[model samples]
Target: MYIPKFLEKDDVIGVTAPSAGYTEQVDLTKLESAKFNLAEKGYKVIETDNVRKCEKGRSSTGRTRAEEFLSLMDDETVKYIVSASGGDFLMEMLEYLDYEKIKSNPKWIQGYSDNTGLIYPITTICDMATVYSGNIGDYGMSLWHEGVKNNLKLLEGRGIIQHEFDLFENEYVKKITGYEGYNLTDKVEYEYISTNKAENFSGRLLGGCLDVLIMLCGTKYDKTVEFVRKYREDGIIWYLESFDLSAARLQCALWQLKEAGWFEGAKGFLFGRPCFFMEEYETDFNEAVKTALDSLGLPIITGCDIGHRPPRMTMINGLRTKVKFDGKHLEMRYTELDGK
Candidate 1:
């Protein structure tokens, strides 16, 4: 794995819209605030033109999005890149991405949700580490959340110890001033399928939103099989989350991945909070996960602080992570694991 250079003072951070962009006043205001925040931190921030354009749930054509992203990759001044936001059309931009250029010019690119369509493939194909976390606009909030702060620290090449947050915003909130903070209400309690193993374990990090990953199956962008196999000795820790997938669909998706030999060398699993799981069939999240993955007998952790929810963890894809979970709370320390 090729771990790209981390961000430094005065480094230019490029923001590009690979899936969707902003058009509304609220969104534009958020973008402006984010830019100001970065600029105040002594870092230069630049955004692609499409980041302010939105139409029919898309920022621009797939090729155009890819072109903008590549432009940043080719720029020597831009040391890091961030996705503007998540949306539905990012998968279309995969075909137009130049993987060779990205591999040659490695930079830290980060995003979550729909951006997984791009981030996941970049790591698996390019053999370079990528970030699966919040977008650039997440910094727009007036008060920075803990998760967001830790994310910045990690990007700055600093070591960070990530612990479970006391609370998480369980439901969505409407932003009035466009600078609202998280109203954390729910007590965080990470669920475990079986604590039957040890209290701590380590593995090379992998996985992202299940909603986006399932679609990449059988596609040319999917190099997951090769990725896991290459790092089989270190063991694989799969951290997965979902955005609106139901219980039935979740289990089926897990089964599909299992059948596809995607988890060939996986040592454990990490599940994040699902956003809008209907569970109409009365199949709860626990039952769905146990039915498909419990047989593997590896440690399984659910209800984690990740995904389309507020106060999420910054997951460095392809980095070796030492995870400490006493069943209720979780802590993680990241390190470079034999990238050569």
Candidate 2:
């Protein structure tokens, strides 16, 4: 994997919208607050022209969004490029992007939710590292949680030691209410089930929102198999979360990935609390996971703090990592191994 340079203080951070554009639906106050917060941290925030534009479920025309993102990637002064927010149709911009150009000039770009479509291809195809964490609005939150702090530290080239979080925000806290900070009302709970014999392992980190990964399956953008094979020596540790997927849909997504050979050479699995899920008539989330993944026989840890939930941990794609869970406490250590 090709890791970009560690971001330094005074670096320029470019903000763009590759998915849904800004409109009355977006919270402008939170975006301004996030920009201010980022500037206060010693970095300049620059936004693309179309970030505020809205169209048919996209921030701008697919070509325009891709062009802005690629331009930022090629900008010498910009140390990082983060999406203004995640939306429903970022996948549409994939084809318009210049992957070869990106491969030649890899840079740090981070976001989650719909941004998964971008992160996965960048790492798997372009071979560059990307951060899967909060979006622009998240930084503007009134309270800076440990997860948010650690995310900044990681981007600054500092190592991170992640622990199971103490609290998480449930679905009741609607995302539309921005800048209030993460209202972690629910007690954090974790389930570390070692289906395999070993309880501890290490591998190259991969994965993103299940809702997005499922969409990339079988597309030309699907390079997961090749990526895993290239890094087969290092192995893969997949950490996935859902965004409003029902238990049945989650199980189906897992089954699709399994059929696509995504979990062929795996070491462990990390799951975040699903933003929204239902027991349905078939099974609950727990049963869906067990039934779908029991065949892999890997150490699977579920209900950790990650994805759409509040106080989520940041995971760097393509980073060599060490993970261990004792059915109670989960710990992770990230190391710079590729020397990029």
Candidate 3:
């Protein structure tokens, strides 16, 4: 697997909206502050033409989004790229992406949620690693929180051993100052689903938002079966999460992925907290996961610091990983990485 070079001092970080662009004044303010913060940290920041423009929930046309992404990839100075926001239409721009060019260039592309449309395809089909983390806007907080700092540290090739965060945001809070930190409410716990006690397991890091991943399961972009098979020797540790999917839908989606052979060579599963889960038939998030994946008997860890919940860890897709869990907490270690 190809892992792009980590960020260095003075390297440029390009921001583009592959899914949706910011239109609200508060959003624009946060975006600008984020850019300024990165600049203060000695990294150059650049944005595409449509980052601040949104119409019909799109930054521009699909082709234009692909074009801007390609432009950043071609730029020798832009070592890393991030999405402006996550929305429903990222898949529309996938077909237009220059896959070959991206594979050849191999820059660090980072985003979460709808961005799975890009990162998933890039890692599984293109065979290059990508990042699943916060978008550029999160860094705009007047006081950078632990999540924001950890994200930047990861980009710098620090390979920090991310520990479980103390708390997580339970619900989405409206942006008032546009530079607000996470309104943390719930305590974080890496719950063991398949077993009552903690278990340690690791493999190639894979997975993303179920809402987006389910959309790509049968599409051409989804080379999941092939990708997992090819990396069977190392196994696969799926770190998954969901956004706004009901218990029934999540169960079906998990079944769909499993039937499609997406879980080939799986060692274990790590599930993050679901952003908005509509319980069905008295089934909760953990129950939905158990209803589908429990039969596998793999060491399933749930309620991790990942996905739409604030203060998520920086996840690297396609990297060999080692997860150490000791009942109370879990720490991730990357293999074949330099700066750990």
Candidate 4:
């Protein structure tokens, strides 16, 4: 794997809307605040022309978004690139993106949700690490949660020791309404369960939002097989989360991934809270997980505070990660292996 250089002080972060763009209908208070927060951190934040442009669920045309992304990656001054926001069909931009150019430049690209399409290709095809965290607009919140703060720290080249979140937002909020800042109203406790009482395990971190990951299964972008083959000895720890996939849908997706050889050498799996799920015929998240992946017998840890759920963890794809489930508390330490 090709790990890019850690970010430096005063480095430039180019924000491009490769998926969805901000528009007049959406409130700009948070976005403007996020920019201010980024500027206050002694870094320059640059938004491309289409960052704020919106039409038909995307900021602009796929070609235009791809061009902006390519230009930002090739720009020497811009050390990092983050998606403005996540939206539907970011896969469209894949056909227009210059993967060869990106492979040569190798800059850090970060985002989740719909941005999963870009993250997978950048890591597998281009062989570079990508950050899976909140979108750039999330930084607009005046009061940053510990999770968000940690995510920013990680993006700035600092290592993070992730433990557990005291509470997680059960519901999703599109436009933080009736609040001065981020309104994390509903509080739900975190429950981490391991299939086996495995105290410790290590592997290369991989995976993202299931909503988008499932869509890339059979496409040319599905490089999971090759990636797993190359890193089979090191092993792969998949940390997956759901955005809007139902329990039934999630089960099917998991089966599809299994058949596609996506989990050939997987050491373990970390599943986040489902954004939307149904207890179909007494089958829930756990049942779905068991029915689809029980045969593997790998340590399957669930109820992690990650994606779609508020107070998510920031994971670096292609980095070495150690997971510990000590009966009571679960913790993860992300690092780089010796000799790369």
Candidate 5:
């Protein structure tokens, strides 16, 4: 994994909706606010035509979004790219992307959820680093204060930095802000289920939404151990997260991965918040996860500040990193190919 140069102040950050069409359902005000936020940080925000189109309730058949993304990749001035939101259309745009062009000129591509489909394939084929962070819609509208700061740091090609881990402890209740009920606050308190201490471990960063990645298995995008060894000789670090999957389903996925030898040469594992919607299934979820890991005999860390939560952190796919674990503290440092 090669690290690209840091984005400069003059660099343009391209924004577009590749998966789902935003249309009217997208909050225009929030988009505008996000633009202002980026501008304030000394970036030139560029929004593609697909970002503004109202194609709500219709299928995402437009290639405009994919075309715009490819165009941005070729443009030297565009140093980074972010998604408007995650929807279920990126898989369709995979074949249309120019992988060679992206490989020659790698830039930061940030988003989560459905965007994982694109992120994984791009990283696998191009060997370029892309970010898995919050989308544009939640820019100024959401208060992921730590996430935003960390994202900017990463954009500068800085190493992974440790952050305080706080758990979401309360139930998120929907409130009536207008005639309809809305969740005014996005912050949720959580407990520290587990943490990876500050330590150094280097490998090509890989993996994404466990469910999505699993679904892609046997497809071109799947990064099976065999596929990974072809491009990456150092090893790989797997990161995963899920919204509200049952313990049984989660266990089945883990078993499949183990059987596939996904963990054969992995350095470690990072797990994001595994939020189970059913209150009664919390213990089941914990037990299933533990059972799966216990059988692997690999180092595992859970409850990272990523996925379906506020204050998200970005993981750059294909970037080699050194994670230092010091029992009470965790620190991540990067290394240059020249041994810097």
Candidate 6:
């Protein structure tokens, strides 16, 4: 596993739209807001052609976006690359990517959702770390929040990054007012809630949305048991999340991973909160997932606020994270390599 070092203050952060079409339809104000946010932290933001040219019907040519990403990776001055948003087209460009170039010059490739298709395979083939950070369309629109800014700050170094969620009664008001005024809770009672706080286990982080990972199965990007075992010689930690999936669908996905041998060499398992399909379903989605993971006898942590949630934290794909789960609390630490 290759541990890329945290970017320096002067390093340029490249922004691009590699999957979905942003083009002129994107909210320029939001993009500027994100740029200002990075600038306030004393970093440079470089927008790429991919962002400007991507449109719903007349987006860049087949491999244009992939080439743009590759160009950014090859540029020595661009230290970190962030996706503008998750879209439907990233998978088509995967085969055209320059893996060797990315492998040679590894840097942070950050995004979630459709970005997972790109990140998962990059970790497997290029041996470079990627991040599952929420995209510009979501958290980037509210860059003033401490949770959002601090999460970005955490990405600037090598250490375990720790955080907890405190949902507000009026989430909309709290979102507009900033997270500082919201009331926090320790009780785990909500329409959709899951929590896992577990022993310190160390491994290279690998995982993304359960649905996306499932789609990649049996393809070139699939991380089969044999593939994971080969990487396990170094160590492997898996993280997963789902959005509004049924308990049965979640269970089926877990079973698929189990059959593919994902659990065979996993050092630790981490899960994001599970949201149900509808309010009518009274079954506890968290408990169902916990039961599935428990059957594997692996050290598991549930209900982490890393996916499809407010104030989401950034998690690198191939980076080494030190995860400790006490009976009541869970902690995660990250360390970056000197030269990547």
- Estimate TM-scores for all models: 0.97, 0.95, 0.97, 0.94, 0.83, 0.83
Please, what is the whole-model Cα lDDT of each candidate in the order they appear?
Answer: 0.88, 0.86, 0.89, 0.81, 0.66, 0.67
Report the lDDT tens digits of candidate 2 across residue range 82-131: 88878899988899999999888878889999999998899999989998
lDDT of 1 by residue, 1-340 (tens): 8998878889999999999998878777888888898888888899998999989889999999999999999999998899988989898889899999999999999999999999999999999999998898788889899888889888887787888888888988877766777778898878787534557888999999999999999888889898989999998999999998888899999999999999887888888988888775778987788888988878888888888877889999999999988877788888662221
Candidate with the greatest lDDT versus the true structure: 3
lDDT of candidate 2 vs native? Answer: 0.86
User: What's the lDDT of the predicted structure labeled candidate 6?
Assistant: 0.67
Model 4 clashing-pair count: 1
Give stretches of model 2 more than 4 Å off: 174-178, 337-340
Model 2: colliding residue pairs: 21-59
Q: Positional deviation of 77 in candidate 2, in angstroms?
A: 0.5
Which window of ten consecutive residues has the lowest lDDT sum in model 4?
A: 176-185
Among residues 3 or more apart in sequence or in different chains, the pairs in candidate 1 whose N, CA or C atoms overlap within 3 Å are none
- CA lDDT, candidate 1, residue 115: 92
- Whichever of 3 and 5 has more lDDT, that candidate is 3
Model 1: which ten-residue window has the lowest total lDDT?
331-340
The better candidate by TM-score, 3 or 5, is: 3
- Model 3 quality (TM-score): 0.97
State model 3's lDDT.
Answer: 0.89
